[model samples]
Target: MSSDRLALITTDPAVLSGQAVIAGTRVPVSVVLDCLAAGMSPEEIVAEYLTLTSEGVQAAAVRGAAGP
Candidate 1:
């Protein structure tokens, strides 16, 4: 993953049972990916998940596209 991707997402056992979440927020990366898949724009995702910024959502999308 790119540094921007790494910086935008974080996984910690204490947080959401270690789900890869948007950095500093409980909103999981999967949620962002799912939102995008469901046709929600980055702005829409940010509206739904207030803690997430457009950049973070974009980063998550990029990572999801890149895959494991």
Candidate 2:
């Protein structure tokens, strides 16, 4: 995949006041990461947040694992 496709992180002033979020949603990347860390499955997350996908959840996990 291109880096852009793999990069789930994004920011836009018109979106969620520019918070870093998964591609197309107001859901902060950290919120997804926290849910995953709490042992919530991707399906569960999707069920709870329709804007999220399994890929998004996984990407959040990968990014979270890669600390700054």
Candidate 3:
């Protein structure tokens, strides 16, 4: 699916210290983007970061790509 979907997943100040991490983890959205950029497949991402889902990774890609 399109990555823009992740826009709905955010870190509000009251959440995640406003660091723009995933909804429930300390892992920043950029970390997910970096892993994809470094050639890590969605399955590998899920394997490496147990907390991440393939769909979440894809959504993060969409969100990261949406930035200015």
Best by lDDT: 1
Model 2 per-residue lDDT tens digits across residues 1-68: 33544497778999888877888777888898788878888899999999988877776777676653
> Going through the candidates in order, what is the number of backbone clashes in each?
0, 0, 1
Question: Which of the two, 1 or 2, has more lDDT?
Answer: 1
TM-score of each: 0.89, 0.78, 0.76
lDDT score of model 1? 0.87
lDDT of each: 0.87, 0.79, 0.75
How much does candidate 3 score in TM-score?
A: 0.76
At residue 66, give the lDDT of candidate 2. 69
| lDDT tens per residue, model 1, 1-68 | 46766678888999999988888789989999999999999999999999999888988987797784
> Which residue segments of model 2 deviate by more than 4 Å?
1-5
Task: Point out where model 1 deviates above 4 Å.
Answer: none
lDDT of 3: 0.75
Candidate 3, residues 1-68, lDDT tens digits: the string is: 46445754677786567767766666778888899899988899889998877767877887877783
Q: Supply candidate 1's per-residue lDDT for 63.
A: 74
**Residue-pair clash count for candidate 3:** 1
